[model samples]
Each structure stands twice: as structure tokens, then as C-alpha cells.
Target: MVVVNVYAPNIYTNRRRLWDKFLSLCNSIEGIWLIIGDFNEVRVPEDRWNSVFDNNNALHFNNFIGAAGLLEYPMLGRKYTFLSGDGKKLSKIDRALVCSDFMTKWPNTSLRALERNISDHSPLILSSGASNYGPTPFRFFNSWIEIPGMVEAVNRGLNKQGNENFKDLLLG
Candidate 1:
């Protein structure tokens, strides 16, 4: 997994040169590749909010991803990964990108945005493992009792029999 934090310069010419070099380097590499971090640019207009969308920048960013054969991993738990100091402007400048080989190897891979506490960008957590640590904790919801068929559904789920042992259940 290759983690990159590209600092795209404000000047358009400089930005193109930097991205070109980066893409060339990535293209030369072999095997599964996963890139993640702040790109300083967005691939689409939807990626930004409360700000003027730059069509040219978006086009360039999308072109870079296509040239590198990298697929942006879908983010979970949030729409925007970045927050301005005033908590007004929002954008998804940080993301995870993986090549096709990497995706094939870890088909269940997922990226989640953790709470943004220290910085403007939210920290991302990526995991491929699907292991279950333990039995899911049961929570009693007072509203559930008022719902129709809730009792029957709960009883059915609780009484369901399975041949798997405790070890299998624990491991999921």
C-alpha cells in the first residue's frame, strides 16, 4: 500500500509538472498499489461544498487517476473528509485509491473516516479483515416493543440453530 500526500502547488503549470512526475513514478511500479492521503484537490464538483468548484482542477485530478489506473475507494460514514477552520467549507480532499490488483486481492476492503478532532482532515481507517471479535452486544430499545412483529422477530433470531461451533462464530 502506497500512501501519498501530494502538495499540489497553487500555480497550474507547477501542479501539472508535479502530478505528471508522480503519475510516471506510480506507473513504473508493479504489483498491487494502494494510495491514500490528502490530495489537495477534488475529482468532482460534488467533492466540495460552500466553495467555487474548479472544473479544470477536477478534470486534471480525474485524468491523473485514470492515467495511474487507480480506483478511488468509496468512503464510509461521511460525505466530506475535510472541514474548514470555521466549519463552513467542506470537501473530500483526502481519499484512498487502489489498483485493480489490490482490489482483487482484498475484495472486501473498506475505508472509514474517523472523527476529525485534531486536524481539518479526518483520519481514515482501512481494513480488509472480516473477522468478528465477539458476540454482538445486545441493546434493548424501548421503542422496539411498540413495533409490530418485533417480539416474533427477536425470538426467531434467538432460537435459530446453527451447526457451527463457538470458534467459528468467534472467528466469523
Candidate 2:
């Protein structure tokens, strides 16, 4: 079985090329195609936190995903995957798509959204081995706020921030 977790950053600007690439890349792969990752696109208005904004890219993304004949795993509970840093906007950009053949063969496969920690984006976890499961509890730590320059770093940009070695921070 082929399990995939792809992150397509800036998908809004490269919809055409990205969709073409996705099709070409998946065409060669065999077995189960479980594509899970942040797509940065919403299938509908209900999928986005800010529907008033013109999101032509999101519409284009939906068309491409439908043409690929993939199954969009129905999201349970939490409707949005991203939150605006200021709490004004939210959207469901993260998703899991599986091919019909894969679903038929592995009926047990499931996907769900995980909680956010340091970043505005929520983590998505997919499990093909489990037959059934429910949402997992997320733990929060106030200590994270005590980290030096943590707030400043977040303001600068979460992705561009210098390596903080989170594992080391926790273990030290």
C-alpha cells in the first residue's frame, strides 16, 4: 500500500501546474493512493472561514480534485484547519483524498484533523491500518508561552523562524 502525506504550499498561485503534476505523479504509483496534506484549497464556501473573500483558486482546486476522481474524506467535528493569526479568518485547507480502488480495498482507512500547537495550521493524521477510531484529545502546555522570544518569533513568521529545536527544548 502506498501512503502519501503531501504539503502543497502556495497552491493558490500554481493551481494548473500543481494539478497537472499531481495527476502525472499519481498515475505511476500503484496500490492504495492515500493522499493526505494541506491543500490550501476549499471545496465550498462552508469549507472556508472567510467565504466573503473571492477565492477563485479554491474553486479551481475543487475542479481539479473532482476530475482526479478522488474521495474527500468527510471531515468530522472541526470544520476548519487554519485560523487567522488575528482570529478573523479560518478555512479548511488541509484534507485527505483517496482513490476509489484504495477505498474499496482498504475500507478501514480513516483520516482526521489534529490540533495545533505552535503554528496556525493544524496537523492531519491518516491511518490506513485502523478499522475505526474517534477524535483524540489534544494537550496544551502553558510552558510553551514561557519560551524566550517565542511570541516575537511567531510574529516574524512561523515558517521562517529560526530553528528552535523543539525536541531538545522539551527534553532539556
Candidate 3:
């Protein structure tokens, strides 16, 4: 089983480009796929927690998703995930979507809204494939180095260790 994540930027007003890229990506992938991120688009006026704003922009995005054959993952928390800084325009900007293939491959894919960490947009967690193992901490260390060399180092370490445990922890 393979997991693919797609994070598209907010296309609040550009539906053509968004739809075109979505179509190209859907046709290109072969296995189970999941597209999860802040689309900045809405499927319907009801999708927004507050419906008093200009929603012409959102309807266009909804059409794009429908035409692309992608289904929205019904939100579990408060419908609104993003709010304009001024506290006037509220919208469901962050969301996750999946194709039928993903359902067949990993039916348990669940997305939840995490606390907003870096950006105003909430973090979307898309757990596609099942894992008996639970959540693992993600580490980020900035080291100025060559990208290809990092790959080579990882490959060499894997080959030498052959799935041995604690190598990463020990090295760190």
C-alpha cells in the first residue's frame, strides 16, 4: 500500500487552474491517493459555518471538485476552519478530499483539524493507511547540505543497518 498526499494552495478565485491541476494529478497517480490541504474552496453555502458572505467564489470551487470526481471528506469539527483576520469573513478553507480508489484501498482514512500552529489555517491530519503503531513525533532539523547527499546517506544507512532499531535516535 502506498500513500500520496497533495497539498494545493488556496485558489479562492482561480478555479480553472485549480481544476486543471487536479485533473492532471488524478490521471497521473496509479495507486490509492488522498488530497488533503487547505483548498480555500467550498462545496456549498452550507459548508460554511456562516453563510452571509459573498459565496460566488466558493460555488465555482465546488463545481471544480464535482467535475474532477473528487469527494469531500465530511468535516468532523466546527465547519469553519479559517477566519479572516478582521473576524468578519468566515470560511471553511481547510479540508481533505479523496478519490474512490482511496476508499477501497484505505477505508479508514480520517482527517481531523489540529490546533493552528504556524499559519492561521488549521493543520489537517490525513491518516490514510491503517497502522497498529500510533502517532510518531516528527523532527525537523535545519542543516545546510546537499539534497542528493542526504538521500545517499539515508540509503547507505538503511543498507548497512537493514531495519535495525534506534539508529536514528542513537545518531541524533
Top-scoring candidate (lDDT): 1
Q: What is the per-residue lDDT of model 2 for residues 21-67, given as tens digits with 9 covering 90 to 100?
A: 77776777666677778776777778766556446776677677777
Clash pairs for candidate 3: none
Quote the positional error of residue 162 for candidate 1 in Å: 21
Say which prediction, candidate 2 or candidate 3, comes out ahead on TM-score: 2
- For residues 12-64, could you state the per-residue lDDT of candidate 3 as single tens digits? 44655766777777677665556676666666676565455446776666666
- Ranking under TM-score, best-scoring first? 1, 2, 3
Q: Give a tens-digit lDDT track for model 1, residues 78-117.
A: 8898898898999998888888988888889899998888
Report each candidate's C-alpha RMSD, comma-separated, in the order given. 8.7, 17.1, 12.3
Rank by lDDT (best first): 1, 2, 3
Give one clash count per candidate, in the order shown. 0, 1, 0
Against the reference, the lDDT scores of all candidates come to 0.80, 0.71, 0.63
Off by over 4 Å in 1: 1-13, 132-172
